[model samples]
Target: MPKTLDDELHTAGAGASGRRERAASVPRVAWLIGPALVAGVAYLDPGNVASNMTAGAQYGYLLVWVVVLGNVMAWLIQYLSAKLGIVTGRSLPEVLGARITNRWGRRAYWLQAELVAMATDLAEVIGGAVALNLLFGVPLLWGGLITGTVSIALLVLQSRRGPRTFEFVIMGLLAIIAIGFTVGVFIAPPDPGGLLAGLVPRFADTNSVLLAASILGATIMPHAIYAHSALTRDRFATRRGGPGARRDSGDPTRRIAWHGFGISRPADEPAPAPGTSTEVPTGVLVRATRWDVSIAMAIAGTVNLCILLLAAVNLAGVEGTDSLEGAYAALGVALGPVVATLFAVGLLASGLASTSVGAYAGAEIMHGLLHVRVPLILRRLVTLIPALAILWLGFDPTLSLVLSQVVLSFGIPFALVPLVVLTAKVGVLGQWRNHWATTAAGVGASVFLIVLNGVLLWLVFTGA
Candidate 1:
């Protein structure tokens, strides 16, 4: 006979015991670190490079506050996303999907999200193509093809080897990105006084306001918010009546343990009574998640700042430094070939790693929001088409990257408003629902982002 849901849960719980025993030998914190790092890749994609480079090159330290502000807000937002998944065992998209009862409303929501994800892909694939051209003189069309192909391979790795392995590989790429982008700052540091002065919130012109929006868009990505919740859900959520279950049970102390990485109840602890709460040790998980998010954001934020500072100190007021290709050539002239090559390498790594993550986010978005599970390969191809088309049509790659970020900025409110609403709902998260202060902060960030995008539109339309 086919097994029932309870039978499946029992089998899963039994299977988890051995893995938990094995995990007991490892450090507890190691189990919680990977998800945020993977999600954080969104903040460092090619869009970020284009936005920050243009900001510093064109304005020279004028928009430093935007980068810093975006990062600060990202920390709070990412933490809320992770907390929602951990407490409820559902991703943001999954939650939104189940709650939006109207079919047309659900489709409408998915459409905007789909556009945002495609914009993300366009930036990443284009960045890869530009990097390949810079490094090996590959034509843009072929380079885009190669980039898309390699990203598919990475997604395949995630499918076959599991999330832990995928995390390790992405983390390795992140290291290369960090080193590649930040090495130049050491070779030629920014003016300390100018850097300090840039901290004061101000804009140089309408163009600077546009770059600031692009920077915020590149930094606080909608897909990353969607992905982080899903990442946590995948990594930590348990089967029904298994670990991390939300239902109440007889045994109050029967906390959830790591499923594959192996944290289990101590040998001395009493066995869980039948029908115990399936809740994991949420306090422990939340603490670890905070550390995970902090580390990931710190790395992403530093690399982005370094990219801007590199351009500000060296490429400021330089003609033809606004584009990635132009910036690469200018870096070679100003800081020599080694620095330029490293920057290209970092851009390449950023493209490769972030595209894989972006593709993963797109897949989750479809599955959760539409409740339709398309094959990953098929989904990857569909998204890859837009980026490739831009390259084939001979649109300016750097300009495309920056504009794509601006598009992302516009989509931010759709993701952020719903997230703030859901996570703050008492019925949704129970005791873990946002406190007044947290909810207010989320509201404030959402409002600020909305206002910033409005200013960008006004400036463009009015020519102010």
Candidate 2:
């Protein structure tokens, strides 16, 4: 006798359970994508574009290794941050606040998050203004003002939709960057040897080191870490599940406590029951996160890799780029005006979108560390002012933007340590605790970045 319809439903349910299991393993591959998306936006920020061009133009492909190395280092740190949130249920800000028993420790975390915002905001405004400047012969001051106002408006536009709207907008910006840069590459094909040389670590003179620092620094962001951890929790919480079934409270530390995560609980919740054994829902977890992470990582990582290749090809040994506009001028000579214009437009979008994220991160830090509930608009203003000043000071918009990358290089340490410490604490992650291998890698990477930054700084000061 063949099975009836009822039996089919039972078998279908079992199959669905396996998908959920896979999804649980990966957590909506989309979740993994959020960080990469954020990274893409950061990678295309004003400073990154300028520095990458300079590296490519000056040394051809000698500095290509910086992009790979930086991304690898950053990937290591970010992966740990993600793991920390998934296992601990607490974001970086929350954990930092919790860890520092003393006032000084608390102050350091908050202050650094604020610094990250300030520096990030500065880069964004400058990037945006430079775009406007390149697109239309606009004055830097006016451009900066407009840039600041418009970014705040973007946040307001998304206010009704909730916070992650900024991230969505940033994703769109990343697309623009990809299109523009890809077009630029098509225009000026890269030389194979210079491009290959760029993939290797070279210590050729002092300026190379500074440019390399900028590239590495591009990955080190305090707020991105805070934002990543928080976004995971926020996304989890919003996924139609309650705390016990889903643990979605933007705290990476709460994995087992989620209920509304589309899973059902006996009685009221999914808490530990002494005598009853609970079967994990096959439908809920698997189809959700795994695939999303796969696509997101691929998109973000590919873009980063492409950018480095793009820079190595176009700018390597071309010369005379005092500004991003200058870099554009060079690109126009090698490539074409149309491609350069597209790049500027994309750069504009990247800066503005990332600006909004910077503001949100700054506000979160203010709220978490200082317990100060500042208005979002005010926070935006606070973050943008420095960037505005930089433009007003008659500084080269492109160079200032590139130097800001160096600021990130110095700040990476502030964010990395707490992430490493919190994730490695076995009590927080339980069985999800970082393996000894992962810990060693994290420690080694952090130390290397620290040393790299130091040498870069020494070179910068010596003007070699």
Candidate 3:
């Protein structure tokens, strides 16, 4: 066999050159893609449409800033999670699982993951069923069954074909989303300044509190954290290093490595010395992560922004949709039955998209929490059963979906506080840890959200 130069180089110094190749092959604004495709479409879920519509129609563009603010915060959070995954070779769960000395810390993380997964499933099952009801005149029970079946089917297809194939299909659906939203904006053009004003924060009585809560819930989610972590781990090709191979694993050394593609030998045996040079795998992991987060978050943010704008123009100022029921009625009046049907279907999509994400997140939680490792088939059934039953019992679909968002809303502050504390610690993220500017931005964002949420809750209770 004649060894070509490429082949020899590939065999001889694959790690170094492959890493170099990775640097050179960085996606051109293709960097702007991957993560966005993951979150953006899901963000455009039918429930989000209703929230934005409810906001815009009632407040007319006044609350648009709420969505923007939530997204800006989300961008920062997702970036940090991905960056940590890259730098640490650990998802938040793994990081927390190992870092927290106490059992309670570990237990809390497990509980949250489990609750979020179940709540998310509830939202998705109901949303999909509702959409079926709108589209095919299917009953709630039948629609729930259908949604469960279809989502399971989609999961099978995704697992078999891989993420690229699955994400591509979702991206196409997102395009349809863009078309639908863009057309909606055209059909009922919003006031430009009013839309602009919506970006500003204003607090008052009325159900503006509820509107704010909805926007926050739709934009910031616990599943996204799990999804981002798992995705980062999946996207990153890791070295199967064994015990005592530490090249300063916890030192958080300020090193950055990039990779194109390289062959790796499984950790054969004990290595030579501390100063001896072997590429640190964690460095490469972190860099790729930043790329993933930056690209994905940008796309998700833009589409989310568009949804708010669309709502501002079409439904924000309308009189009818003061509540969920009002939203259905206003939708019919403004865009007629055809468009209203589309919104319901959109809601269904939101639930379905998020449900799958919920299940995936749940699986990860199980791995971290109960140390349970159920097969994916069993896992799917376990989550689906409760959700379907809820639908069958005549649980109010819209309200239940809305509650899922609320759970997400609360989960954000809890999940993020730990993330900030854990990653900022010198022991965990080391050189890749949060710097001054980043820490400030993250903490400020979390606090602001908590305060807004508090106000929302206060109003909800007092009916102020």
User: Could you say which candidate leads in lDDT?
Assistant: 1
Model 1, position 144: C-alpha lDDT score = 93
Assess every candidate by TM-score: 0.89, 0.81, 0.80
lDDT of 1 by residue, 58-138 (tens): 988999999999999999999999988777767888889999999999999999999999999999999999999999999
Name the runs in model 2 displaced over 4 angstroms: 1-36, 163-166, 238-301, 460-464
Query: Which of 1 and 3 is the better model by TM-score?
Result: 1
Residues 159-223 of candidate 3 have per-residue lDDT tens digits of: 77655556666666666555545455566766777766666778655577777787787777777
lDDT of 2 by residue, 147-212 (tens): 889878877865555434555777777788778766766666666776666666777878788888
Query: What residue pairs clash in candidate 1, if any at all?
Result: 245-278, 249-275, 249-276, 256-280
RMSD of each: 7.5, 6.8, 6.9
State each model's CA lDDT, in order.
0.86, 0.64, 0.63
| Ranking, TM-score, top scorer first | 1, 2, 3
